[model samples]
Target: MITPAGTTAVGVDVGTTGVKAVLLDEAGRVVADAAEEYPARYVEPDGAEQDPEDWWAATARCVNAVLARARVRPADVCGVGISSQAPSVVVVDRAGSPVRPALLWLDRRGRRACEDRADVTGRVLATTGNRLDAYFAAPKLAWLLAAEPAVGQTGAGVLMANGYVVSRLTGVRSCDTGHAGLTLLADLDTGAWSEQLVDLWGIPRGWLPQVEQPTTVVGRVTAEAARATGLLSGTPVVAGLVDGAAASLEAGLVQHGDVCEMTGQSTVVNAAFEASRLRRDELGTMSVLPYPVPGHHLVYGSMVSTGGILRWFRDEFGDRERQLAGLDGDVFAALDELAGTAPLGSRGLVLLPYFLGERSPVWDPAARGALVGLSMASRRADVVRAILEGTAYGLAHNLEELGRLGLAPRVLRSVGGGARGRTWNQIKADVTGLPVETPEDARGAPVGAALVAAAGVGLIDDLAATVRTRQGVVRRVLPDADRHAAYQRYYSVYRELYPALRRTYDALATLRAELAP
Candidate 1:
């Protein structure tokens, strides 16, 4: 049912490849939606960047599109919540205009700086639940400081996508705990930027944006921004989360022992807890975020690759199927048919699924993927099935390690592109020996952003209640006893393959670089 006017909220997700906006009423149903794609520039061989202007342009397009589609007046949007890809480093000048291209999260060009400053990073992650790798923002920021002397003169401070847009909207520069965690500047326990880290990285503390809770009202939209994006000038903009945390909220995994696993080009498993502090051990990773309420914390354990591996197969081996799927038919149906032809365990073939270096539990980037037990008799179907099972095994391994730390959960909620495929969902259930549930919308980040905005505007008391209203959207996939048993044998082998192939991966890395020229 269409909602009565003037009680709706809008969620904006500024992701890596595109920007997505969703409009929802007080009842949590989506009333309008729009998406706008942008480009990520590979400025160097291993570097990725995007113009901060592109993000704002995309945001304007999405906001305008959503309001036009919903036929709602500017006054109807009670509040707007923003979520964006984490770890993006944007340097803005005193005038709040970007001084350089934004350094994206996927850019690996800063690896040397990240490694050379490992000690600084280690101390930071000890409090933030992330390490000094190319994934976080500080190293990328440091790289910019060294590479662009112009940055030192023109740059005023480092702000992420959320803060960048917030500045554009309100003329007040700020970010929430979620994006702060990605910066490796915030102490996870205190949820404040650390002076010790600032000294360690030798960056000016004055440049950092003030941190706020996710649902706290940052500021009202500026008249100029309102004119540019069609939002009411006085509309309230709330502090929002990183995309993964927003997805967890949309999946309703906001309580202790609740887990949300997102499978996109990457897979990230986030677990929430009410603890004031988490142990600083290295078994897995943790990040502090607003606990669906004030004074709460959430931690995340992530894997670098999940569906990305499967996507490689679909593109390489499913050319004919893709052409057929172009006609609006199910492309995955063809893939599923191929997987079905192969037996459980892929006839002893196993895949490691570490195309990108792994995160959490293992915490080793030197780790690489492998396919074992290949033979002349092995067919394409067998290889395809092995990759699918390999990804499931990776998740199972991550969950198992999470269990060792006393972080096990009863239910696993799935959301993201990979969760929609029945065969993939079934493989996850069978491999993990756990029931998997998916939300009706399955568009987790945007939904979560809307809920956060509603909570901020007093439409919902808390995140848990907001999530409860949408529980009916979830459908559970139960474990299959026989399939679980077969996967058990395969998983044992899968776990062993990584350690066994570590030496091979190191040599292969060397070989790959040597052959590059």
Candidate 2:
């Protein structure tokens, strides 16, 4: 197929920490990108919220900056796509203004609501291919209905993050199929809203948005959105996938047995498979949802604290590194250099990175972080290296569980901020004894959105073929035989720490709750 001339697409990703916008040309190369940050309010112990207006403002600023920086004309941008964090609750009134701050996917305020539906757990699992947990949308909506009864009575609809953004841009209410799966309210078999589940939750059918495929052009930019984002009015807008699925698509994990590992605030590993291959009962804590590609599904697992643990260390213990960063030096680079000096196994020290409990494989909410084999001879670098190695161990554990379910991935394509660090990717490869591949553009979710936009506007014919041709791997990390052998011994011991200390974690949690003032 001959390539279209003078074509470009804009992709905006609304993430937990910030919003990122990327401009991609016909060949899927990033022309320019910009990011804007916003605060996530954590007023209550288990609450996390963000202003929907803030996301809209950031999206505008990011998109404008990308176009200006790249010197691209608005007319050249033929299409726009949006991807965002999923399962969030963004209540909008009739005029499309937010009724309340969005409840983030990380918020746990809906735990009670999730627990109230325990009787139908089996049916929910079978119908939705997901567990009934606070992480899903139904529980969050239930919490909103009880906490803010006025909004429920009068609101126009409750949408996910990307859905809300799309509404603001085009005056349309719709969500992609991939994100609808996160609601625990969509029927996997029929690929639509489940009236039974929605009625059971007591939420009005009007509250849910219309569901559409990922590449569908749901609407065009309104004059207001055009003025705010510096894009031409009437530009096509595609209904994009959830953030994780977009990353998977951009990483070229479109076929069965293809896998992608996203390492950012958390570690999410997704493997693609045919829809018929989904075995609901065997997927313990792993979510099986529809992939962007038709007739395929994504089986995935997550660890709540992967790069989050490393960030905690950098904030609390890396004072010297922070000072260096203030002087135009990179703190992570300094830490990486220091960790490289440490020997294998960090001199027998092992660190468990469960600072926020865990989600997959171990699925223990009471699990806590631990530092074992600490000695006077151990230097700060040993602790740093141990943190990196510990996260790799956790990844290996989840991979083992996926293997048991007959979804083992042959090679893991790595993406996210961690993929930029060669040392970390190499360490993960060594610990898991699997080859790791990094794409030329590690920030792939937004790029994937742009690709979806291209396909939506008929600029690209075949999605999978376009991805394979355009997105190339920049680097490959292969596990060293000797290092892999050594890691096996340490990983064996690492696997035992959680089981051995489960009782202790429970005791500490109980005491803390009992002693609350």
Candidate 3:
């Protein structure tokens, strides 16, 4: 139980599928935490979206629940920080209500916009340090501007998930620099939005929210927000970061060469590196974004389906296990235990984890998931174990891409829901041939947001120094040499399957699109 005497800060993360909030004490301990889930609407075959109001509502519930569970005085909460999945974006009206559901990162509808505006590709890539892909905010924003009838240019403002929530909390619109860097609009070198790119999108300067450093205090919680969220009316609210960057901080990414793997519904592998040291051309494959700490950056590769695949399998196949876990109990533990019994390589079964297309290295928006080497003898355990191995193989593939660029991280510090799966973590360790370390608090981004709040309110000096001090690597899974060798051989086969089946994936997408009622 949290005692009232000590000062506490609140951290909130509005993730793609849920919101998690943590009560963090001054010493960097997560005293209490709460989470609430909301769903994303699969708009069509290749589209995924969520109501911005759901994000705010889920965030409010989580914050209030955390405070209530801790029984802490609202005044004792020194500050609040927030993080969210990005560069997912939503347009809002003057009253801060969503014009439509947010275009989540999983949405692939922006591919049409990207193809239509190919002329700006070169400048966009150079300016943003990322490709003009459907997976990013600008293309999605452009698509929405053209497709969303309610999103009028005169009244709508583009905001990332966190920006919308920040507006509701403080009645002030703000975008964190960390998210801005990936919008395909921000000039990475200048650390600000590129007017040229925004002009290319035909979006007015006024339509974009002002971007601030993640630790900068943008505003105080308004009385109205206080009533809704249980925060002090005047509590400081910092401009928060992308969830991946925040998770990096929680994983103890303090310096250049430090790496973190945020293994949530999706997986984002980040390797911290000084921008000055690496040239743009050298890091072309992955999305490069400014790290939460100013003057720092990370090269990130996002795998769209990692833990989500397991969740999909559990929802579709693990019915008995799910029922046995009961209400509010995790079915993943039982699923993991079942998968653990399967041998390494899952008896030659391989899975393509591109259920939502893919990003980083592959960059194929039409790519779909597949299961290979399946025979009549295949068991449910093999399929479950294969899912874990498949994600690990994808991570290995990403590491190989990083290896090409000379940033194969030595020790991967992991944080997220998937990092808790012993079977999955072990598979990641063995497949990547890197020791996988997980922090004590698996609720990473929220704690990282709390640290950001603590930093904004002067509770800590030097975000990097504070992160270094609060370093917590509770468990480390090292690779088994024999299993690693066997997996590498299987991974080579996994690599071949994608290229061989690339044409079929496109054909499948076309057929599915045509047949949809």
Candidate 3 wrongly placed segments (more than 4 Å): 1-6
- Indicate whether candidate 2 or candidate 3 has the larger TM-score: 3
Ordering by lDDT: 3, 2, 1
Instruction: For candidate 2, write residues 430-471 as lDDT tens digits.
Output: 998899998877776888888888888878788888887865
Write down the RMSD of all candidates, one decimal each: 3.5, 2.6, 2.5
Which candidate number would show the highest TM-score if scored against the true structure?
Answer: 3
> Where does model 1 exceed 4 Å of error?
1-5, 36-46, 118-122, 282-290, 311-318, 327-342, 373-384, 508-517
- Model 3, 215-280: lDDT tens digits are 888988999999999988988889998899899998888677788889878999888878787667
In candidate 1, position 91 carries an lDDT of 89
Clashing pairs in 1: none
Clashing residue pairs in candidate 2 are none
Which structure among the candidates has the greatest lDDT? 3
